[model samples]
Target: MASVQPKTRTFAGVALIDTPLVNAALQHARAIHDDMSFNHIHRSWVFGALIASKLPNFAAVDLEVHAVSAILHDLAWDYKSTFSTPDKRFEVDGANAAREFLGREAPDWDSRKRQLVWDAIALHTTSSIAKHKEPEVALCHFGIFADFIGPAFPGGIISKAAFSAVIEELPRLDFKEGVKQILCNLCKHKPETTYDSFAREFGIRFVDGYEVPSELERILNALDATAEV
Candidate 1:
């Protein structure tokens, strides 16, 4: 008998199943199976990487788990988005899928490591309720922050309302100081720069060009004030 070829899954203008597991997850999220695309996953990865770079003493193990989770975090959206707002259930579904896939394909990964991946996926989409005490949870929260910053392509605009929500949800810290530090680091590359610099460097071009919204503008202004003093 002749050998049979297995069918393949194509998504988001490309065949991503051949890609690495993390990349495949991103592609799956962005795939055209439904209304949402892998763009969201792509944005999450970009933002996650940037945040990971900035975090103090971020663990490589935690980062690896976060990368995997960020890509696969919304894999169940194709089914979940249809019924209701993509929420906790959606995350649980994705985590379950990730655990199953990882078990079959990455058997070398220990249970604890695999669980970290699942935990990251479960929490990445539920940042508001995430417990910062857990390193994986913090990494997941970082990925969510990346999503909010509009790192994804097309319609990656962070509206004032969205920014407000993030500020309210984010742990109370010296955000203005943090922004200033990030901005100062950014200015080293371009003397006259704005939020667009941050966006462009991280491949987060706004759909309508890189314009800082009013809320972000206020944040930037506060950062500038702190820097001047």
Candidate 2:
């Protein structure tokens, strides 16, 4: 008897690019994120597919989860986002939004799949960890980082031309300023939520009057207390 063959997913360097879900996710992201972030999401998915192509089980990867995670990773960057919640990390806001979107649009998805997408978006900012999580989570993190900082992929997985093509399709528009503005908004509008993430340090460095105790200050205080003993 012949062995069964697993289903293989095709890659087009775009997340659900030709599917209705792509349009839906794009529309949803456009309403919430600035053009920069919207482009980031697009490139993130494409870059993620680039990363996925090098994985051991590349053909078996779930494109739906990848598309949802990439498209919604930064959905909460804007305060006006329907997914934005006060006093929660930006990642959480994006994760919640992804969950809600799936519930409404892809209600047939099992809880396990939903949770995978949620983790992918929620943990995209966490380093060393997201890279080790499930495939969707890890790939989503890699995609976000690769888009922002060239293809810093392991073993130089993707070729320059491939990366360039994705960039041409989705140009990164004023991404630096967009990131700065989003960080400022998070600190200024939702100061409480920035505490546990890099946004906290960003607030201290960029946002006026937004002060958090420096790591050096904390170390010095610890040393002073030890000397008193």
Q: Which candidate's lDDT is highest?
A: 2
Cα displacement (angstroms), candidate 2, residue 76, comes to 0.9
Residue 17, model 1: Cα distance from true site in angstroms: 18
Q: What is the lDDT of residue 143 in candidate 1?
A: 56
Q: Model 1 over residues 19-57: C-alpha lDDT tens digits?
A: 366655555555533322354455455455545545564
Q: Give the alpha-carbon lDDT of every model.
A: 0.51, 0.80
Among all windows of ten consecutive residues in candidate 2, which has the lowest summed lDDT? 6-15
TM-score for predicted model 1 compared with the true structure = 0.48
Cα RMSD of all models vs. native, in order, equals 17.6, 5.1
lDDT of 2 by residue, 3-69 (tens): 6543443344533434566568778887877677888898888787777767775556677688778
